[model samples]
Target: MVDKALNDLLTLWVTIEPIGTVVLFATLSAHLPQAQRRKVALKAVFYSTIILLGSIVVGQIILSAMQIRLISLQVAGGLILFLFALQMVFDFSHERPATPEKGHDISVFPLAVPSIAGAEAIMAVVLLTDNHVYSISSQFVTACVVVCIMSVTYGLMLLAEPILRIIGKNGAAILERVTGMILAALAVELIMEAIGVQRWIN
Candidate 1:
């Protein structure tokens, strides 16, 4: 039981990538005041918690109704993650406007959906809490792990200003590219596992 919980913790940690989220939060919220930044972080966490926890509870059922296999979801998520990683590694949005558009609630769009609780993260929690593989009690444990990671992500986002101050723009850029590379590797592994290539290699 302890091993399972530990495994769940690690999987969620990697999929959630709190450090990467901190970089994103720092960059996106740089223009906002401290109070507004905190609110963005809080709202992001709130939205992420709802999305992740909801997936834990009913995600599989919805997938079943749609006849979507977990492996299919894994492959699709890997592709999406790979594309997003490419954007990060290449800094595709480097030429975009410095300021986010007015009336845009970033907390809901990029920050909440794809940054903090991304496609990979959503698929991961659902896989971890598979009804056939995990008991209700075990699923509850996984949900707790999700909340724990989200809490850590929120704390890191709260300290984004200080972290960015220490790291500076150059450091953040370097870290983002490095993280993109790591995420790309993980995405490949997810795809391989879903397609059973990993088992063949092993």
Candidate 2:
């Protein structure tokens, strides 16, 4: 059943990347105490669930109706992702993560936007509605798969607290930089494909 779920939402699961969820959770909750950590995690996850479900329902239709081409969407999404990557790279600090930081809230911004329902996630969902790629029933299953993945995300955040103690803030910051590098590469790939310099490898 786990395999089946993965198969159904394979594209999205890959783009969403549970590891990325861990990074976002760790980064955003860096400044919170143990008690407030749970509340913040719940809030982020709840916001993430809303965005995921909303995107699944209306994202493709809106994109198609707006006459937005896939290439255009890719370029746009990629740029957005690049900006997000930049944010992650510079936001990490060596000091202990305590007290609320200005302009950076755990509940929104990086967590909900590019973290959970980021540009990659949105673009992949838009591409999922292909006629030959999957059947309608399969697509519906994928939507349910989206929900399951988000539920896992919620659980992962709560779990991040203890994990944070083990890894420490420095380790989490290193992970964030690595993910940023990956996202930067992904962004370059999108621009390449959009410009006809490359095509799907797989």
Cα lDDT of model 1 by residue, 92-116, tens digit:
8765444456865778756786667
Report the Cα lDDT for residue 148, model 2.
84
Residue-level lDDT tens digits of model 2 in 1-202: 4564566577777877767777667755766788878887777767877776666677767767998765686777678777767766675455644755776665676677666776677767656644457677766766788778878888887888888898786787787777678767877876777777765553
Least accurate stretch of 10 residues (summed lDDT) in model 2? 91-100
TM-score of each: 0.71, 0.71
Error of 1 at 83 (Å): 8.4
Model 1, residue pairs in steric clash: none
Q: After superposition, how far is residue 196 of candidate 2 from its true place, in Å?
A: 4.2
Q: In candidate 2, residue 190 scores what lDDT?
A: 68
